[model samples]
Target: MTLDPEDEKILTLARSARARNGTAEGAAVRDETGRTYVATDVNLPSLRLTAVQVAVATAVSSGAQGLEAAALVSDAEEPAQEDLAAVEDLGNAILFHAGLDGSLKGRYV
Candidate 1:
C-alpha cells in the first residue's frame, strides 16, 4: 500500500533507528497531537520490549492521550501481539509494518 507523507516519515525514522542500533526491530508512533516517538527493540537481560511497545510507552509517558498511527520496521513479517496491544490501548490506530529496507509489508488496525 502507498503510504502518506507522515507515515513515510515514521517508516524512515523506524528504519533509521533499527539501522543505527543494529537491532532486530525499530518502531515509530505518531500521537493524536502530531508528536512522534521512535525506538529500537530493547533486549537487555532485565528488560525485553519490542520496538513498538517502547514507542507506545514513550508516547504515553509523554502525555499523549491517543495514537494516530504507528509503524514498525523489522525483519518479522508481522508485529507481536504485545506490540499490537500497546497500540490498541491508546485507541484505534493504524500499525504499519515495513521491511528492513523500509518498504511497506503489511498493516494492522
Candidate 2:
C-alpha cells in the first residue's frame, strides 16, 4: 500500500518500538489533532495489555479527542480483537498491520 508521510511515520515508530523492546508487538496511533503515540505490549504477570491498547491509552491520557489512524507492527498476521476494539472506542479509523520487517501486511477499517 502507498502510505502517506504520516502513516509511514506511525509505522516506523511502531516498528522501532518493537525492535527496541524486542517484544511481541508494538503500536502507534495518530490522533485527530496530529499527535502521535507509540507503545509496546505490556505483559506483566499481574496485568497484560496489547500494544494498541497502550497506544490508545497514551492518546487518551494526552487529551486527544479522537484518533485518525493506527498502526501495529508485530509477528502476528493480524491484530488481536482487543486491539481493534480499542481503536473502535476512539472512533472509526483505519488500522494498519505491518510485519516485523516493517512491511505493510493488511489494514482494518
lDDT of 1 at 107: 88
What are the per-residue Cα lDDT tens digits for candidate 2 across 1-109? 7999999999999999999999899999999999999999999999899999999999999999999999999989789999999999999989999999998999998
Candidate 1 vs. true structure, TM-score: 0.98
lDDT of 1 by residue, 5-60 (tens): 99999999999999999999999999999999999999999999999999999999
After superposing candidate 1 on the true structure, give the runs of residues whose Cα lies further than 4 Å from its correct spot: none
> If scored against the real structure, what TM-score would every candidate get?
0.98, 0.98
What C-alpha RMSD separates each model from the true structure? 0.6, 0.6
The TM-score of candidate 2 is 0.98
Clashing pairs in 1: none
**Please, what is the whole-model Cα lDDT of each candidate in the order they appear?**
0.95, 0.95
